[model samples]
Target chain A: MSIKNFILFLFLTAILWVVTIFGQSNNPTLMSQWIFDAYNKKEQTAKKIKGKKVIVVAGSNALFGIDSKILSSYFKLPVVNDGVNAGIYLPLILEISKRIINKGDIVLAPLEPNMYSYNHKVGVQVIDYLFARKPLFFWDLSFKEQFYILWHIEFERIWKGYNYRGGSPLTAGFYGAFNIDQNGDQINTSLKFKNQGMFKDLERHHKNPEHYGAEFSTEALGWDYLEKFVSWCNKRDVKVIFVPATLMKHPSYFNDPIEKEFYDKKIIDEVKKRGWTFIGKPHNYMYDSSFYFNTNFHLTQKGKIMRTRQLIKDLKSSLKK
Target chain B: MLFNTYQFIFIFLIPTVIIYLSIPREFKIKFLILVSTIFYSLWSVEHLLILLSSIIINYFLARKLENSILNQRFLLFAIISLNLLPLIYYKYSLFLTFSESSPILPLAISFFTFQQIAFQFDIYKKKQQVKSFEEYLFFILFFPQLVAGPIVHYKELIPQTKEKNWGEYQKDYFNMGIILFSIGLFKKVVLADNLAPIANYAFANIETISNYDAWLGIFAYTFQIYFDFSGYSDMAIGLALFFGIKLPINFNSPYKARNIIEFWRNWHITLSNFLRDHIYIPLGGNRVTLPKQAINILITMAIGGIWHGSGWTFIIWGILHGLILIISHRFNWFKIPSPIAIFLTFFSVLLLWVIFRADNLSDALSYYTILFNFQAIPINIEFNEILLLSCSIIIFFLPNSLSISQYLKAKPKLHWYHSLFVAILFFIALKTLALAPAQTFVYFNF
Candidate 1:
């Protein structure tokens, strides 16, 4: 084995990797279906909302939890559900908020626990890179976020593309199995019920100490973005109300309710101090664990009605101010 | 930058190796130290200072020990303690205080500290002497073995660098390095990293893991640690070989060993040798009475475990290995068949990995309970996980990377099929690494 031969081996391997990477990148079938649907929903929402309507900006919690038709009929305005999968971090959420938020528009954002986690933010950005593959979306991310995307997702796809030749079969099955409406909400009640046991496993997995057991922090970059978002909305004369997403009440998961309440109060106070609206107490959105879908934040049909009705009351009172 | 990353391989290594190969012999060592320093500093500039300070302090101390024959023992103890001070402060500070917000452990502090301590001890014992501070510096900070190491001794490494044609590229070593590095990269990216997610999920959600899932989790970690560390060691050796220096063989299909004694001999061979020569032999080794020898083994293994991380779990894991070794040595009560012996040895190793991989004692305890409980539930196995586990089994039977490199030397011209196989493996590894999260080598934490 000579040095020249070894060099030749390296050269040939590099060429193969580059060719495969470019070749894979060109194939649209390589994109995960859920990611494609979410990207499509993101691009179409601007055209769908005709008037200065009430816009819901959130993660998958809102996409699965909110019934925009119910909100639109009740609020007497066009409602755009701009919630995508929660994997997209708060920076992108802020970018989305800034883009669609016009003067006199009402924005309802029910924040999930993931919005405040750095790890979750990276998870969101990874999804954006893999599924959306949008240049402007990638550009909109912080330099740190962009670097993470390059290293973790795009770099990963070059190799994963070889094995996952035509994209994720699980995601493809879901694309065929369930439904995503024109408003970008996942309307898969039957599928959700069918995978009830799997949902429990997922819920338990998410509740693991490694995932969310650490105490929530106010100093997260996500929280910092929250403050900036409120300020941006204030200057633009768009009414922004920070609300709590409907959560499953699992005592084992929320072991420290007192600490949770303290954090909630602190967030509400911060939002109110910025001259923005703070609607619905955290307790108002807590339901029995059975009233949820897969995740803690995703509400069941009955749970959504309970949450939506309570939210309507809160909004009526907050708007009066 | 990690060995498995594009940044390290393409952006950093390939160009550096070419430039390093082309340079004059005199500049080669200097270039390595500079790049190694840069590599160490990538984690933190402050940590790099700490590494430099350790080298500077140890270099002068070794010189002092060399100069002072009468007070060599005293200087050795003081230097050893001084060497251990930073490691103790960084690695054990959080454990001592039970604080959540402790400082980060400097990467490879344990490894470099041990390597330097060995050098200083050799000086104190008058077995070796340093010719120059630069040679000593290169020996201590050589990037290939710098972080996690074969713990290359002063005698073996320094003389190699001083060879007349040290800077000139040897075709055989270069080619061997290429195959070894590629194999290591494949082992890491394709084999170990793939197993990580499932293993992590099972361990992280311990309550959800059933009896079969526990087996799956430990097996994943068992092979994960093997490939991860062995892979890193091979890369280190390969990288060193690129500069025409050979690092000691660190792994040799360790899982194939039929007994605990054989396993230690094959696994982390350098560390095992370091322990045997420096730690175990100093404590009376096997030359003493049987019970005393047993005690020495326990002490050595316990210390070896503590060298890994700051935790009671690691200590327990070490003690279990020591006990297993003692039992294996003393007992000939039954003549177990080779297959049975290998299976039992592997099974014991698998169980021990649970303790090693768990976050804490309680975490390991919960996993053990689930493992033995035998709950009649469905095993939550993923499609890729089964494939990975099947692939991992080949590790026990296949000729290791080092041996393959040896074979390549004799048979320099690779068959077309062999070339194609290596190319495909390398291609898959590269692609997987691109798509996956940049996983730091498991040993790097030590």
Candidate 2:
């Protein structure tokens, strides 16, 4: 091959790549649309709610694990579940939380334990999908940050996105955005039963128990963003409460006192140092493995009720003070 | 720093190549050494320092050995030991102490150490002359083969360095390099990585997996390692070609070998050559009695396995190969029908690879038990079966990168269709690379 032919080959490849990306960005898959719909619904609920309300902010753990309706009924205030995928990373999640929160509102944060140490840049998949729906959010980032995220986006994802032929979000059944209730919680009763695949996943974790649990570190970027979020809430007179995300009670963690104490001390000390109001002991929310739906964090319907009742008790005690 | 990554390809390689092509002939070698230093340092600065120290120490020792007369043998032994010290400390400390605590290994310590040792041995035997310090440094620190190597010889590369005409046949070499590199990248990203999940799933669930999944896992791994290492070798050779230097061919379709002896000759050919010339010949190779030859083969193969890693599994893997070689030497397996002999050889290799890939002996044993259990349970895990079958076909039927390169060289010129095919392959591989995190070459751990 001559140099001219080789350059022509490269030119052809560049054109194909650009075409794939453009096609995929214009045609959003059902999964991406579902994510966008869920976000839009939660944002609208947070905006339209009259006066001070209880804002529940977290990852999918809160979306699937919490019953905001129960919290609203007990506290006699409107509530909105502003939870999304954890792959969006904590910094952006907290930034999104700011739009929902208002002065004199109570902000309930049940962050997943791993969120404490999620210091890496946002993943390519999340950025690609979210940027198509919410270009403003991506444009808001600094040029360097935008480039870092863009550099990681793979051509495979664009090709897959372009090839996706699934129907719209409305037809996605139980796992679709339409399943989300008015209070911003996923309330599909078909997901009440435990998934069998979860057992295999849990078995793998059982073999390597140390892989579970939160990796908390003060030096992490998550901590810096979290501290800033608390300060933002303080200045606005919005109350912030930090609570543990619900988790399956694996014997490896709950049975060993030393392991249990290690995590307990880490969470309590970090929360105290930040001067955020932490309600409920970390162990209080850990339920048996049967309560889990599919992942270690997501809860079944009955499990969600149990977790909510515990949260209600903790909130009742802390709100009185 | 891996070749498959965006940062390495776009940020490092493309820029480095353009700059290298534009530089004057005299400065090209020096420029490469500087860039290669930066490349290694990007992976780790501390490890780069260790590499430099080894190069400086080995270069000086080689020069001394070439000039010295008294205690030449002792000096050679000392030089070899000094070259091996860092490798032993970083790689074998856990095995030696039988303790849990072990230090992180310095990258490429094993490859560079072995290369330097070969240089010293050749110097002592008066088979090699000491070159300029800069040439020696460039030979050692050349980034393409610095980490996982074809275990290059001093003679093969040094003479090429001295012929410094940048313009002659530059376009031809660059074009060939692009083709070889694209093929390598496709094999690694599209084939090897896709097979990894199935193998990993079965190995992670050894006790519970059925006989069907066990066989699938073993086959997946068999082809995975072959494509992974061979693809890496092709990329290394291709990158060297970009600078108008040719590297020794490291793989030549070892899966097609009809016997264990043939397998050794084809697989990891450079390492096999090193063991043959340096270790086997010195230990009274095949000129001795049958029993002594067997012992010599066993010792050489055992050292070969130990060189790969510090595990008992690696030692056992090595010894098993030695036993097979002995059997191949004694019996008339080659007299059997060609198809059956090839099948038998491939089966034996696939079995041994389990021990090589396992975390420990117990896992390997359990995996073997599962493989022969004869249970008919269904495969539960989700994997692309089509991809596995495709990889198998490619391994058995494909002409390999070297053959393809030779075929292209025979042609007067590449047609437009060839360029289009190459472009599509390259684009597909790049897209696949973007789909997941880049997996390191399996040989890099050695």
Q: What is the TM-score of chain A alone in each candidate?
A: 0.75, 0.81
Q: What is the RMSD of candidate 1?
A: 9.0
Task: Kindly list the per-residue Cα lDDT of model 2 for residues B316-377, writing each as its tens digit.
Answer: 99999999999999999868999899999999999999998888999999999989889766
Ten-residue region with minimum lDDT total, candidate 1 chain A: A169-178
Query: C-alpha displacement of B74 in model 1, angstroms?
Result: 2.5
TM-score of chain B of each: 0.96, 0.97
Q: Return the lDDT, model 2, position B123.
A: 92
- How high is the lDDT of residue B315 in model 1? 90
For each candidate, give the interface RMSD after superposing the true interface residues on Cα.
Answer: 3.9, 2.7
**Which stretches of candidate 1 lie above 4 Å from their native place?**
A1-321, B96-101, B332-335, B377-381
Question: Per-residue CA lDDT of candidate 1, range B1-446, in tens?
Answer: 68888899888898999899888777998999889888888888988888899899888888788998586677788998999888888887787774665678888898999999898878877799867888888998888898899898999998887677788977767766777887888888878887787789889999887787787777788888988898898889888888888999999887878889989999999899989988899899989999999999999999889888888998999999999999999976248888888888888888899898999999999999999997676755766566565766678667888778778777847665555556666666876775667899888888
lDDT of 1 at B293: 97
TM-score versus the correct structure, for each prediction: 0.68, 0.74
Best by lDDT: 2
